[model samples]
Target: MRAWLFSGLLVLLVGCATPAPDSLYQQLGGQTGITRIVEDMLLRAAADARIKQHFVEVDIVRVRDKLVEQLCELSGGPCIYSGDSMEESHTGLHISRSDFNALVELLQAAMDQQGVSVRAQNQLLAHLAPMRGEIIER
Candidate 1:
């Protein structure tokens, strides 16, 4: 009877224990990984004719820093996004759907280059999808 009771207690304890799963931020490899992804995307964008013009006049370093912060926060990391609102920053940029799509593709390429899992990439894209309306003025 004591053996059975002990087994039951052990089972109960095990069942009630909660294991902490890794957050998306951790899956994205924390701040350093996010920084790498952002930098890679920016570099690709700079050379890609489809979106390069949009970045011609902007401060690339500031954009990179803000993108890193934004992605970090979006993925549940410790960083906070201190950049301007999507609409506020994108206003008057005349960004079209094609331009936005090109940027997204560049970002995806960057993530792929970093070996980020597709699941994590989709999750991050899902989080950012809502902001498309705010970013595309045309």
Candidate 2:
């Protein structure tokens, strides 16, 4: 009876143990996956009438590099962002809520295209959502 009780308790303890946390970077398929998502997003954004104007004056390659860095760092990958602060970058744009929503939809669609899990997409979105105040000028 004592041995059986000990065995049961051991099983219970093991079952109740917390699992290790999964990294968002790994969930996003590491750097390669991140790059694919960014590329898709940029293409979608460029074609989007609501947001395409914003890309008109910018160097698309530079923009892509910065975005890749930003998303990599945001998702716990090995990259550093070399871009201006969110507020600094958008200070003169006078961006509207609709523009913001348009970009977000494009990002979501890009993530979906890359086969990113809904949970991983939500995780990235939650991390970025706080930047709205800084990015939206109007």
lDDT of 2 by residue, 42-125 (tens): 999999999999989988998888888898888877677899999988899878999999999999999999899999999999
lDDT of 1 at 53: 98
lDDT of 1: 0.90
Model 1 ranges with Cα > 4 A deviation: 1-21
lDDT of 1 by residue, 24-80 (tens): 787777888899999999999999999999999999999999999999888887778
- TM value for model 2: 0.82
Each prediction's RMSD over C-alphas, in Å, is 7.3, 8.2
Clashes of 2: 0
Q: Output the worst ten-in-a-row residue range by lDDT, candidate 1.
A: 14-23
| Alpha-carbon shift of residue 50 in model 2 (angstroms) | 1.1
